[model samples]
Target: MGIITDIVLPVSLAFIMISIGLTLTLGDFRRVAAQPRDFLIGAVSQIIVLPLVAFALVTAWRVEPVLAVGVMIIAAAPGGVTSNLLTLFARGDVALSVSLTAITSLLSVVTVPLIVVTAHQHFVAGSGGEVAGDLTVTGAVLKIFVIVTVPVLAGLAVRHTMPGFALRFEPLARRISAVLFVLVMVGAIYAERANIGSYFAQAGAITLTLNIAMMAIAFYGAAWLGMRRPQRIAIALECGLQNGTLAIAVAASLFHETLYAIPAAIYSLMMFGTALAFVFLVTRGRPAAV
Candidate 1:
């Protein structure tokens, strides 16, 4: 577990970020700036609303302090690559999905630390205070930048410099990212096997509730805002499918505590089943592509 946390987790996360980048183009960023409303809604739902809702759930559920922090950390993470894939499967706006994901991934380098620090102060400080010591705002930002931003930028650079190669490699990169994500989740669960059942008992219901509520909010909220069906689907997924791998990596690498990573590991496992159901429900009898 120690070696996996120290070595495998970070490397796996970097690969995932790189895969995200390989799918990106400057146009994805530009598209967000050009048509800001839908993008803003998706980003706000993810970056701001999701964490607030999770915090509310944490308070209402009276979750264990460490597990509460874990939930907050997962909420603070950007939308996962899985969201983009799911959006495509659901015949949603893939372009919007990519734009939301790319923008939020960059923004999370700042937002994650801010949210995590606040959660630490609120939840962990009154406790033993050791977890707070293990995590500092500067260290969190640096880890995010190095593991998330740098790899993404490198992949984007590769795409720009060798367009044909990037095009050919994107599918394989995504496949590798998916495999690495599973391995990371497994490592997180194995590391906490002694308390896995207890952790799940504490976190499973809350995480599932959060995931469902977020998707409902994003989908109906977008509809109320007069967004198209595709945009609604994209927002729903972006809001729901958080980057659990990143959350777990941050928890394990920074806090060195299996307890802190438990919610993310459980959420990651739960999301695949829920997301698949979401895809089927949303895409039933609909066109295959947007």
Candidate 2:
């Protein structure tokens, strides 16, 4: 477990972030400024609305304090590399999806810690439990900056200076990152293998509900607001397929609780099924409905 958290988790997450960075360029960031409306909507959905929805869920459901913090951990995560790939598969705005992932990921340096700390305070600390010792927003921000932001900026630098090498290596990097993701998932569940059933049973319902609700809210909200079909698909899927790897790392590293990482582990396992169904539903049906 120590090896997993200390070595496997951080390295795997760093590689994933680097892989995401491989897909990004300066233009992706510029796209945020160029198309401010969609970006704003996507950002607000993930940053503000997603956490709000999660808080509402945890509070209303009266989830246990540790698991409740786990719920908020996943909620605080940004869109993963999978979101961009799934966006492409869903016939959505690939560029917009990539832009959102890149932008939100960078923003998570600040936002992830903010949400995690708040959740810890409200759910864990407020419950009069011994909270994860000394977890502060500022401390989490620094950890995320090192684990996420620095690797990402390094990836961008590599791509910028050595475009040929980056393009050649990106596919392999992505495959490696995917393998790392699976390893992390297996390790997390295996470490808690004894508790897997009880943990999953307790956390699964809430995580699944959170996934479906957010996707529906984002997709329908975008549609109702008259956003383009592709953009709607992109944002909705982005909201659904969060960076659960990052969430797990945050929980384990900061809170040092496998208990707190349970929701993210369960969530990583299930989000794909829901996302695929959504993609199938829209693609098989009429685009006009969107």
Candidate 3:
């Protein structure tokens, strides 16, 4: 379990990031400049509002401190590649979804550390004295950079240098990433199998509420902001789906405790069901695409 949490999880997360990178290009980032207002709308909704909402839930619910930190970690995560695919399914703006996911992912190297450390300070440290092996901002930034930014950058370089190869291999890499995600969840759960039922019981309601709340927030916010239907759908799913793998990695690797990862793991499972229903609800009785 130690080896799996410390080593295997990090390596697998890096590869998952690399797979996400395979689908990106410089243009994705440039989409920010190309459409700054819309991008800002989505960015604020995600990077700013999501964590704020999580904190509210944590504070309102008075969740267990470590688990509250876990909730924050998952909330802090960027959108995952699955959101891009779901955007396609919802007939939303795939290009916009890809752009949002790519930028948030790159931004996470900083954002994740900040959120985690803040949550740790507020939840764990505030609740009790400082625990041993507390995660510092600097240490978390470095760890996330090594496992996240560098891998995504490497994948981008591969795509640029070998477009044909990247095209041929990206699907395979994404499939492998999916398998790895499942394995990581299983490993995390198995490691804490004894407490699994309690963790889920404690975590299920909050995580599910977070997922549904954020989906509603992003969707209605987009609509209220006068975004088109497809853009609204894309923003909604992107905010809802979160990078749980990265959240788990932080809990398991940075904090050295899979107990903190329980919410993220459970959140990861709950999201797919909600996302599928979201897609169905939005896309039903609709045209194939815009």
Error of 1 at 173 (Å): 0.6
Superposed Cα deviation of residue 102, candidate 2 (Å):
0.9
- Each prediction's TM-score versus the true structure: 0.96, 0.97, 0.97
- What is the per-residue lDDT of model 2 for residues 16-121, given as tens digits with 9 covering 90 to 100? 9998888889899788889999989988998999999999998999989999999999999999888888887789998999888887999999999999999999
- Which 10 consecutive positions of candidate 1 have the poorest summed lDDT? 126-135
lDDT, model 1: 0.88
Off by over 4 Å in 2: 285-290
Q: How many steric overlaps are in each model, in order?
A: 0, 0, 0
Tens-place lDDT digits, model 1, residues 42-135: 9889999999999999999999898999999899999999899899889898899998887789888899999998898888886666654556
Worst 10 residues of 3 by lDDT: 126-135
RMSD after Cα superposition, model 2: 1.8
lDDT of 3 by residue, 1-290 (tens): 67778677887899989888888888887877898878888888889999999999989988888899999999999998889889999999889998888888999999999998988998999888456395689999998898889989888899899989999999899788888888888888889899989999888899999999999999998899889988899899989999888888878767766778999999999999999999999988987845
TM-score of model 1 relative to the true fold?
0.96
- Looking at candidate 2, the ten consecutive residues that score lowest on lDDT are 281-290
